[model samples]
Target: MLENGKLQRSLGLWAIVGLGLGYMTPTVMFDTFGIVSKQTNGMVPLAYIIALIVMLFTAISYGKMVRIFPSAGSAYTYTKETMGNYTGFIVGWASLLDYLLLPLVNALIIRLYLESLFPSVPPWIWVVSYVAFVTTINVLSMNSTSNLNGFLVIFSILLIISFIIFASIQLYQGMGTGTLFTMQPIINSNVDMVGVLTGATVLCFSFVGFDAITMYTEEAIDKNTVPKAIFLTVFIGGGIFFTASFFTQTLFPDLSVFQVVDDTLPEIGLYVGGKVFQVFLIAGAFAATTASGLASHSSVSRLLFVMGRNNMLPKKVFGYVHPKFHTPAINVVLVGLVSLFAIGPSLELITAIINFGALIAFTFVNISVIAYFAVGQKRYKTGKDIFSFIIMPLLGAGSTGFLWYFLHADAFIGGIIWLIVGIIYMLYLTRFFRRKLGTLDFDEREDTRAVEADVKVSSQG
Candidate 1:
């Protein structure tokens, strides 16, 4: 067993998904739709339903992979198992970028919302403060931050629930109401496919980090807990997001939030709670983004650990473990620095680039599940496992792939460039390609000569 250090071992279903997620996700959901209000016609909440289905299917594959392997590398481990190592290395590489800026962006969002609370301080300071503190706390390791995540999630949920109840009150009283989301704005945005995709692209942000729970699967009490946490978080979290959005949209009949343009934060808090919970709303936003940054940092660290261990990356950069803290210290620092730069400027491009990687990861996971079950399931088969793994993943992939076609041209072009760059780097690093995306391995376990060489090296050392 790994020692209790910065790494965690006991995260359950609820804590892993709920708390880490709550630390930063809600605001992403709100902001994405908030920007697309006119496009969604107050039906911005509906976008989450689509995101849920997409994430759920992908989660099925994740849960299956984690249950069988439960390692720290997340998709790196899963892809290696189902596909092979070179593919896994590429995945690990991509995942590094995904989580790297996650914290920085989260910090940035927290800073924006914090301005609502501390009107006097410069917003950038607020942002810097969140990035610093959240990094320090996460660096403290899994236990301390788990507790922090728990409190943040509970508080944020409670406040959101209150907002919902207040909205219900106003609705029941018939104080003021919109026509419950007419479809014109959604069908009619000038941006058309581009607008919807742009709006939905932001919606994708809300769905990105739910998988961070998998990186800690080795530490989880039971493998079953990780998958359950993932699915439930998608459902429950999606519900909270969609419900609040629906009500808030309806509360102000005249605003027409779904028209696909920038709008202020919904007045629902001030309308229903009437400023009593203004501070809480701000806190909820801050906590959500902070959690996002923390989760991002954690995932990136583990992905680097996997790559370095595989010898695909310069191992020494990630090879050192903290003597006392027991965390992957060097890898953590490197990830933070890379993420800080990524977060610094051109965030829209940063976010758009990251989402494409995530979507590609999702697409591959779906394909992996399909490949596993085809002839591979015979290697690891159970009747029930086949249905969820095979059936659900297929459905999830197929559904979300539809959404992918609607993606922004910038995202599409950017994603293509990112993958091409990764491929070129891998050829040089591995000393020329043995094969393409889905058929390479780093473990050396299956290579007769390579395995012998590893054993000889260990003996000589």
Candidate 2:
């Protein structure tokens, strides 16, 4: 263990990618299928494609920024370093809506699954138990959390493969579409660009995990490994979503088949396979939720820790890392406590609000790339430099902005209210702009010296 409460650098590229994929929660395609399909008029796969394209561009910008400033603060750090302290605070504050609520989202999902399976039990019981277990795991050690998440992610992928195979067999036997390969799922007479864009806005929630991996940079085996992990996570997660959605959409070309539009995973499972398959599907969904809860819980805690370390939040609590666990115990427990709100809000409402914060962070991260490289460093002279520094991030910003135009009205209201609260808190923290905001210290020389001293003391003893 390192001295002075430093995050242990033990995560390799694959581990980080696993956490990212887990954070994305591959099974979410099924959870949100009915709603997105209804919104897009049965073009769920097209919505995924649109979201994938936009996320890819933003992923590139994230890659470039991580290479420059490899820290746990993610978009907040990038924006702070390039844009300014105040803008970065607002971005970070907005992002909290995404990070903070994700664990609650997972808890709510688990409650839904459990209620479907056992309607007799009170829903809050499941939420509380799930949050407690996930929070406990995260508070113990990040390595254990990563390892468990990796295993669960692999298990969830196998279930997705299983679903695809079963759906394929049914389709070949003259089921919904009677055949797999067709452009009908992508586009039909009901195809509407406006609906597809709206669905894409919601689907943007699915891609937020790729960027969340940037928070693990300080804990990664090497800072350089994080950029590669970010791309791999996005591509891998996107492929799974597109493939699964394509087959599922092809199998059921109309939303009339689903009884409950908001929750479709159980129905999809029962329809494709049988009772047995539905049981397995529920198990996989449970695994997916657990994996996502752990990853998101850990991520939000770290983000809180960074903010606390900079005195943006209460330093004594959020900044406190357990000396033995090397984990943000206080922040973990706090997030878990907040997750108890799962009993209050609906999944659709939470997802809409999450997309709002996610889009905000994505837009700013793309813009930060332009601010840091093109304007701050003046590296937009060469062809390659212009493409890498200017054009690429510009496209990223434009794509995310397009999605913002289609954001849900509830999301705008919720996001604006949250942003206002953040502004008020920021005003108080800086004493009405009289005091300057504190900055994050990314230097590692002090940590290195502390480790060296600990080693010397051990040898002397």
Candidate 3:
């Protein structure tokens, strides 16, 4: 048993990876396939490839930062420690858009799936029920959440494999393209660069799970496990997205078959395997959404708890960890309340809005790497240091910036308004620069070492 105000360190590598995969929601490839395919003119796989490359560079930066500051705060902690408190607060506030809205996104997707299956039922019923269930599970304990998420993630992956097999068989029988291997999905005569770039921007939302795994650092069994988990989550999630999109795009090769492009999972399933398969696909989708809801809800609550613990938010509400459950109970409930808003928004609107904040967080994490290592630590003297601390992160930052060029207009407007609100609140928090904002203790390494030693001793005894 552990004391209050501390997250338990019980998660192993695969456990962390499971949570990451759960957060990524492997089944999302189907949900967004028709929309992306329409935008890219059946080049969904190409967009995924571009998004994966961008996320890989950012994932490298995340791995480096986690080794230095192993805290639940993630991007906020990294930015604050490396840049300054004010900037850190802004980045964290922006990241809240990604973390907070993600659970809502899951709820929205679930509502879509449920409404498709049961047309007469009201959408709010699905959203409210899902939010309540996910919140209850997350408020219990981290280990329970991880275990449940792991099972769901595995089920979702198996379903993806099933779909791929069915699609492959159809292709071999001259159903759509008649060939499994072709450049049609990657490039064709009608390929548009702008459309592909826009598709890539939207697809970036799928890769947010890799960075989200960093939030579990405080709950990980070993601090070193985080860096490895980050890489695994990125590559594994990317592989799933790319492979699924490739086959689906090849099989359909166009959006004319999908009645609804925004949510095409059901139609894809129906066309590929029939009505029975559609039911199974919906079940898989629900499982995937539930797993993602658990992971995202848990992650956002932790971020709130960390901010509250540092006095950035209301310490009494957000920072209060339940002594019995050892989880951020209040924060968990708070996220659930926010997720109720899913009853109103369109899937495309929410998705584009999420990309705004996500890109900001990704861009800064890459910059934070340079700020911490190259500028602050002066590690730019050696060639290896220059490559690791400077060049790579710069590439990451530049690539992320390129994505921003294609951000939706509504997303930019919404993001700026959120940032302005954050700026006002931050100003009041610090008394207009008259006082220093509260910060996490910088002696995390020494503290981690002491805790590890204590655990070692206890286990031996």
Candidate 3 least-lDDT 10 residues? 1-10
Clashing pairs in 3: none
In the range 305-409, model 2's lDDT, one tens digit per residue, is 888887788888878888767788999999999999998888878888998889889999999999999999999889999999889999999999888888889
- Model 1: per-residue Cα lDDT over 1-461, one tens digit each: 21222243456777787654663376555455456565554446555555666777787777776666656677767777777777776776666656665766665555556555578986656655555676676565665667777777776677777777777777777755534434433233432454445456567667777777777664465556887887777777677777766676567533542342342443535556667665566566666666667667766676666566556666666644554444676776665555444324655666776776777677777767766665576633777766766777778677667677766677778767766788788887766866443322333232334334434533553
lDDT at residue 243 of model 3 (Cα atoms): 96
* TM-score of each prediction: 0.81, 0.95, 0.96
Collision count of model 2: 0
Give residue 448's error in model 3 in angstroms. Answer: 3.7
Which pairs of residues collide in candidate 2? Answer: none
